[model samples]
Target: MAVRRALALSAVDRYAAMMISLAVFAATGRILGPAEVGMAVLGLTAYALIEVIRDVPTAYLVQQPETSAPAVRSAFTVMASISVLAALMLFLAAPGLAHVIGNDDMYPFFRIIAVALLLGPFERPLVALMRRDLAFDKVALVNIASGGCNAIVVVGLALAGFEEVSFAWALLAGNLAAVAVAWALSPYRRLLGIAISEWRKVLLIGGSSGLWGLIWRYTDSLPQIAFGALSQPAAAGTYSRAQTIVELPGKLLFVVVSQVALPALAAQRRDGRELKGAVLDSLAVISALQWPAFLLVACLAHPLILLLLGPRWLDVVPLVQVLAIARLFAPLELMVYPLLLAARQTGRLLLSAAIPACVYTPVIFVLASYGGFATACAYLVLIPVNTLVGYLMIRRELGVRATEVLGALSPSVLVTAGSAIGPLAILAAHGFRFDLPIGTACAVTVTAAIGWAAAIVASGHRLSPELRHIALLAWRWASPRLRVGS
Candidate 1:
């Protein structure tokens, strides 16, 4: 029951964050030009890379509750040390990176972002601790408050014509707000003192974890960096917009899974059978939703992009289509990475990421350099291969058969895939010639509704027994508000 509450709270938090982000993206794009938006992406990418680098120690700390305080102190110390070092390096390298990306104007923006990057680590580990304790309602409030403050700051700055700097300031404000909120709410009482014994233990776990972060971040960021370097700012803007299309749903799933799965996996790590069942259940549920969502996004990308992002972003439609389809498998793939780590299979997780990093880096770079944005987008074909490797590694770690994983996912895939084709066929015949907004809304609404119904039916039209009980309780609680038509 506590686990269920954590999940519910996490989902609600994600939904709130998603709503804020949608508004932020739309407002920022409308107010700032494509070049400014491109610079904002650069700032975010740098921040994202640093965040990944710092997360290893924080994650190590959060994974073990008994040692959480000392581990968190050591993690904070490590983040401080690395933050100073990274700021120095970024200050030196910002000019070079700006030059490489063909945007000299971004150098100052990158430098300003360095300040916020240093501040982020302070709050990040605290939030992780809250999550470790299954305190997601508090976590949700913190995210909403921080993100809301950021939206207001960015919008105000944009109105004052701060342009690119507006986004940077917004980041600084959010990081600062999160630090305050998380510090106030955290249960682990610790000062900023580091112990050598604690450091050694954290380093042992986090150092290896650090390599994985480096590889994963470098791999993930390469696509964006490649786009920024090889393509124009406007083109980068379009590609970035394409990413948001794929990322919205991805972020929603990721938020809930990360919030719920990590603690759940840690609690059950000693029980292999239980762990296997949990993994299978999560795979079944997440894949059912993810596959259909991504497939429908791919099918509706053209009208959706134009409708959401305005005509300037129309060029992103094809790119969004490619990425959306590619990411259909991402939810399942992503689910395993956290479970693998929680089950002490970090080495396997690193190896899985390394395979793609080795194989696809040159491919993405080569294609982006010569082939252009669409060609760069074409690199999504590697996702299935990546998922297969991850699944194999996870199976090996759990001593489970690959067939078990595949078997659970087969029904959802078939049902949703079949249902999604209907709207795609409809869109094809009618085209986008009608009222643009109405047509796109109709396409997304009808397709998603049909796909969901099909999925429910194909899942035997029966909720999990646990789910059914929860639904009944909810209806009973709301019975006073219910009205039956005569």
Candidate 2:
């Protein structure tokens, strides 16, 4: 119930944030111009490189209970130091990076973005404490407020003709507001202090985890960096846009799970049975929604792009499909990373990520250099191998067998994939015409829902236990109203 509540609040927060972001996007185009907005998006690659500073300290705190004030203080102290140093370093490197990307104007904007690194560490202690107690309502409140504040600042500054600086200033505003809100919600008022022994333990536990963070962040941003270095400017922008389209759903899934999974898993790490049950249930819930959604999106990509993005983005159709499929196999890795975090087995997590980083770092550069169907094919080939290695680690460390995991996911994979057939058929039929109207899309959705219902019946009502429990919960509330209506 706590997890569900957190997820519900998270969903609301994400929706609200998305709306705010849309406003900012609109404002940037109208006021700051598209070029400025594009440059702001380009600057996030630098932020991604420093993102590990945010996660490592949070991990250190989340694993420890809120009562560990000394450790918290030490972690905060070290985190703040790292943030300041990172900001300084990024500011120093901004000119060089801007030069490399051949955009001399971006140097100050990059430096301004680095200021966010300094403030973000201050928020982590408060956030980690709230998450440790499952006090996500407060966290959600803070997030909504901060995101709203960010949009207002960015839009206002852009209207005032701040241009690129508006984006960077908005980042600072957002982080500061978040820190203030999170701090208000926090109970402790611990002063700054650092002990070598405590810092050593945090480093020992979170350092390797931080390495994985670095690897993950680097991989995510490497596409941009590589594209900037190797491909045409238009090519990099195209990849960014296509990625924005394909990764939204996956990124949302990641945000929700990443919020709840570590704390929930950590709470249950003591009992093997409980831990295993949690893992399977989480996987089932994830598979039930994500796999079908990915397939549906893949099948309906052309129609979707036509409707939302217009005819200009037709080139991204195959990339969208390949990435959706890639995300299909992502659960195996995502599920394992949090479990390892709960177990304080960051070494294994690092090992798991390091394998893929080696392969894909080069792959991203190649993909940037040569992007059409060939790039998509390389992704198809490499991502599964990465999943395989991660699964092996999960099995060895957590005693999570392939059979048990598959059993948990099988109902969803079967029924949901079956559901996608109608949508897939509709898209296939319209492929030659390329005239899928909005009504056609609606019909596709309705047909898919019917197919989903039929598949459930055909499967003898085999439902994921997680889904079944949710249904039963809903039924308890809805049954009385239905009885009265009848």
Candidate 3:
């Protein structure tokens, strides 16, 4: 498939999944209190950390120049083994983990969620092979189907008063849906078999990458975990929600791009092409899209929370704003992992993750004791440090000089400033009140979007050409309909 088509499919999947997830969370947030949400958050945090390890074998398969049937089988076997072990460990540790987190009520939540882990080994290898071939249509189908199932189950159960365990059940339903869809759509069904002969090769390839992913994921889960264990009741849930809101832009961009980037970059490397240009181009596009969205989210956090999650979650507004600001620099490091993986610099990626993990884990744990806001403050200090470390590592591997990187990102800075114009004006007009009327909030969002498009055209950023092409295509498609109506 063409790269543009792949990206478009991925984007459709991500946006659809995002809308479904947002709806589910919105309903659940209203139905469940902070404590219940916090319990779910803790259970999901454990699940997330285990999920990272599952990606290792997938990466190994996708990065290969030629994935043999034996290798694919081995990858599944390894993934399945790891999933079973992790699920077992989580199940056995659930009680103790609940005790450690000072929430005996979370024991069942953890155990129930562990069941979802078993479904990964069934779906991941199939999806990875689809990704390797750039079969985004199938990939998108699997994701949307699974996400829809998850949303339906979660909302239904939450409404039925399942409380936090509703999320656990929803996860199981989603994974089962993913497994079934992936199996039906993937051409690799015949490749499934017991093959431990290639296990060594798979392990060697994915080990460092897996470790890197684990540590990277830890950076996200640590804050919530710490809050769950050390902070005031409901703090973890509030922080989780704020982090979720702040991360939406990044997640949307990253998921869509990275799904394409890894296999595409690996292909580019196999064909003996330079990677620096691709890396820089990715940074430019990601920043142009991501920074403006973050800025808008930061500016409109209050009204957004009120509209989407309701007044009960009003306390999340400030946390979202702070996290949005801190994550402004996040887009800079967005391409680092894909670049490193493409270059087969997995060891360097591991080191990069390790350095940041060591720096932030201790500090975030300390901050979590204070409160949700205090934990959010830690990101202010941590993200820049992490970004710097990641860039330094990327410079050494890809020779991406700081000056060149800055040159690439400068236009995005202008775009972000332009995007902020309408939102900031509205805020000022409203006397900087975080809580604006619903109609006024709608105005802020519309203005921000308009300003963003205007800035993209006015500044002639790298993304402008793509936007122009899309617009021309859109006009062409619409003109025929207009003539028919006339």
Candidate 4:
């Protein structure tokens, strides 16, 4: 499949999943208090750390030059063993973990979430196989089905007053749905068997990735865990929600791009194509979209919280604004990981992850004791430092200079400035207050969108031509319909 088509499918899938998740989150936020939400976050964070191991097998399979039946089966065997063992360990540890978090009531939440870990062995490797063939349409189908089921289950249970454990049950249901859909659609549906002959190869490639995954997961999870342990009852949940909101753009853009990037870049390398141009183009496109989106989120933080999580989440507004700004340099960090993975530079990838983990984890933990607000402020410093380390690594590995990277990103700066004008104007007019009337908020959004479009054309960012093509296609489609109606 063409890369663009793959990206489009991934984007559609991610956007749909995001909407479903947001709906569930908003519903639950309204139905459950911050303490309940915090407990759920703690449980999910623990699950996510364990889930990092599951990605190792998937990464190994996806990056292979070619796959045989034995290799696929071996990957599956590894994943299944890891999943079952991890699930059992987590189940046994739940009580102790809950006690450590100062909430013995969280034992059930952790145990329920552990049950979802078992589904990983069944679902992830199949998805990886599909992604290997660039069969993103099939991947999209699986994701949409899973997400729909998850939304239904979560909303239903939350409305029934199951509280935070509703999320745990919904997670298990979603993974089961994904497993069923993937099993039905996977080309490797009949490739089921166990073999360890290639286990060494899988482990060699995946070991570093797994380690990096562990560090990366902990880096993200530690702050929240710390909040759960050290801060007020609501701090963890509030921070988690703020992160959810701030990460929407990254999840939408970076996740879609990265899903397509690693396999695509690996293919390019196998074909003896130079990766420099592709890397630069990706940076340009990512910055152009990501920067403007984060800026808009910062500008509209209060109204967004009002609209999405209700007034009950008002404390999250400033955290969202701060984190959104901190995330401006995120494109740099996002570009590095897949590039390293594609280049088979797992060592460098491990180092890149380690640098940030070593630097920021302890500091964030300390700040967590103070409050979520302090923790958010720490990211303002942490992200830039992380980005610099990543940029240096990219430079060292790819031999791409600062000038080249800056040149690619320059147009995006203009585009961001242009996109920010309307929102900033509105904010300035309102003395930078985020609490605006619905109609005014709508006006700000529309004008900011208009400004973004104008800037895209004016600055000639890489995405401009694609935007024009989409516009032309839309016009062509609408013209005949309008004439027929008239």
Candidate 5:
């Protein structure tokens, strides 16, 4: 029942948030120029950095199941303090940072977003705590409401001629809304007199996680910075759009799993076997759902881009395709990332995160300078290689064999391939372009449905009893409803 609630609520929140964000981007992109959009991206990048910087304390506070309310509050206090300091420093230094990235216009936008940074600490630990407690329903409600509010505010500001500033303002409004809702729902209130020393236990944990998070941020952020420098703002915006679309499904999956998985794993931390089993099950479920999404996006990149963003975004199709190729491996990254945290493999986690950070940035910069966005994305082809290395390390620590990992993921691969073939054949038979978006969507949908059905059939007619039971229950529930309607 809890899982059902979480799944249902999360699906609603994810769908709503995705639609709202896409709407905001579409509306704003029409109003703002490339440079303004670039600054908007820069503002978002800055905000992400600030949050990464705060990740240490916030992560530690949220991850520790044994932590007392007072201790958790104090950790939040420390993070809040650091966030304020960072925001202030960044606000003062926005001009220099903007200039460093070769965009003077970003300074004002960056400064505006810096105020939103202060709200990050208040919001982060709360959501983290809620996730730790497995209160996903509340989390979903809060996220949907927050996203809805941000979307409305952004559209309003765009109409009011704020242009690029609308994004920054929308972020601030969203964070404010989330913080308010989280606080109202939280058992404890923010205290003005919370002391720093009370947070010593989780402080070190946060600091370590924060350091690793900063490295991960650098890994992801370098592409944007390099693209901005090597290519034009329009090019960077295009790349950003590709990333936004490619990442949407992965982010939705991450949001749902992250909220549920950490606490679930942490609760089973002592039972390594059970924990490993749970993780495998999670990978199976995620891979089954997520693989089709990336495949669809990759197959339909050109049409999807044109349909969603108009002709101006056509340039992003190739880059989006490249990204789609790499994103097929994203679920494993999501699965292993939390497992490492739960296993107290902090040093290994840092090493795993740092390696990608260290390798990806310079490669992108050099490639972008020599070639273009597509070449830079070519670097990401190595992600599967890196993911293999990560899982090997995780397996060693968890005492699970590589075969176990392979076995768990094998079903998903078969199902995903089965589902993808129909779409590929149909698209190949009738070229990539279609007369109508609706027609393309329908074709893709039918293809995927056929593929999934084939996959279930091919899984040897002895499907997992749990899944079989679920199908039976679903049919039993639906048949009566169908009859009633008839």
Candidate 6:
């Protein structure tokens, strides 16, 4: 029941969070324009770069069955210490960074962002506390409230004539709201509890975990920095929006699922069979959603761009399509990431993350610098390649064979592949132009969906036992109500 509740709440939270954020971006992006939004992206990029510090403690607490007060306090202290140090480093270096980027506007923007970090570290343990106990209800409330805070602050400030710094100020306001709400919900107290042994444990555990988190963020953030420096801020804004559009759905789902997944997987860590089963099952579920949704978005990027971002932002359409296609391979990483962390294989996690940083970074940087966002998006082949490497490592370390892994994913892969044929044919028939009229786009999409649903039924994959049971349960409950109403 806890697992069921967590899943339900996570779905709700993702929907709520994604909608609110989209609304926020639509309002703010239209008003502020891309250059100012680009500046905001740069400032926020600092947050990701510093996330290595907070990840250690959060991962530590989540993997524990129960955290002692002293352990919690110790984790909080270390996180706070590093967060402050990172903030100070950014604060002092902001001016120099702006100078290097040749943008006087970025100096104060980065400084304001630095101030938000001081208040954010205190919220980590509070978050870990709620998550460890599977209290997703509280988690959802806090997320909704904090996201509301960010939207209100950004929109209100932008309407009041603030431009570049509106997003920076929102960060400060949002972080403050999150910290305050977390404190209200948490039973943990602020303490200066310093224990050498505890610090040693955090270092030992966090050594690889922290590095793994940092590498992932660095990979995600470096392109923004490059665009900010090499391309126009407007271009950076376009790329940033593209990145956000492709990532938004996955991020929303992953945030909730990964939180629940870590603790759940950790609980099963002692049983190798159960842990392996958990990982494969998760991959299947994620593949069932991720493949079709991302691929459909790729196919339908035109109408999606028109409806969501409007005419002036149509430049993002191609980037969005490419990115959505590239993201098709993300389910493997998403499933494996939390499982590896739960299994205490942070060493392998670090190596997998490092592979991309070392091999793909230079390639992506060149692409972003010379070829632009579309070219960079095309390089997402690295994701699948890196996942392949991780897969072999998992087989070696966890003794999970390739056959077992492929069995879990192949149904969705083949089914989704079969489903894509109609869209591809329709797209080809239309000469592959994405900027179709709304009426035509609607017709194409509806026809494609209908055809896919029909194919799924015809193939009998739609009647898989799990889905069949769900259908039976739904009908059993609803048929009685229908009879009574008749």
Among these predictions, the greatest lDDT belongs to 4
**lDDT score, candidate 1:** 0.74
Error of 3 at 225 (Å): 1.2
Off by over 4 Å in 5: 1-19, 29-35, 63-73, 121-142, 229-231, 259-264, 272-284, 329-331, 370-372, 400-404, 432-437, 461-471
By descending TM-score, how would the candidates be arranged?
4, 3, 6, 1, 5, 2
Report lDDT (Cα) of residue 291, candidate 3.
89
Q: Any residue pairs clashing in model 2, and if so which?
A: none
How much lDDT does each candidate structure score? 0.74, 0.72, 0.85, 0.85, 0.74, 0.75
**Model 4 C-alpha lDDT per residue in residues 355-382, reported as the tens digit of each score:** 9989997898788888888999999899
lDDT of 3 at 412: 92
Worst 10 residues of 6 by lDDT: 188-197
lDDT of 3 by residue, 1-486 (tens): 497798788778778888888888788888888888887887888788889887688877887777688888899899988888988999999889888777777778778778889888778888988888878889989999999999899889998988888999999999999999998998788897778988887888887777877888888688787876773448888888899899888877777567777777889899988788888888888898998888888878987887778888888998999999999867667687888867877677887889988999889888888788888888988999988988988897777788998898999989988888898898899898878887988898899888888899999988899989989999999999999999
lDDT of 5 by residue, 109-196 (tens): 7787888888876777777777667677778767977898898888799789887678888888988999888887765444323556
Q: lDDT of candidate 6?
A: 0.75
Q: What is the lDDT for 73 in model 3?
A: 88
Question: For candidate 2, what is the total of clashing residue pairs?
Answer: 0
Judging by TM-score, tell me the better candidate of 3 and 5: 3
Clashing pairs for predicted structure model 6, backbone only: none
Ordered by lDDT, highest first, the candidates read 4, 3, 6, 1, 5, 2
Best by TM-score: 4
TM-score of each: 0.87, 0.83, 0.90, 0.91, 0.86, 0.88
User: What value of lDDT does candidate 3 attain over all alpha carbons?
Assistant: 0.85
lDDT of 2 at 424: 73
Query: Model 2 misses residue 453 by how many Å?
Result: 3.5
Candidate 1 lDDT for residue 338: 83
Candidate 2, residue 275: how far the Cα is off, in Å:
5.8
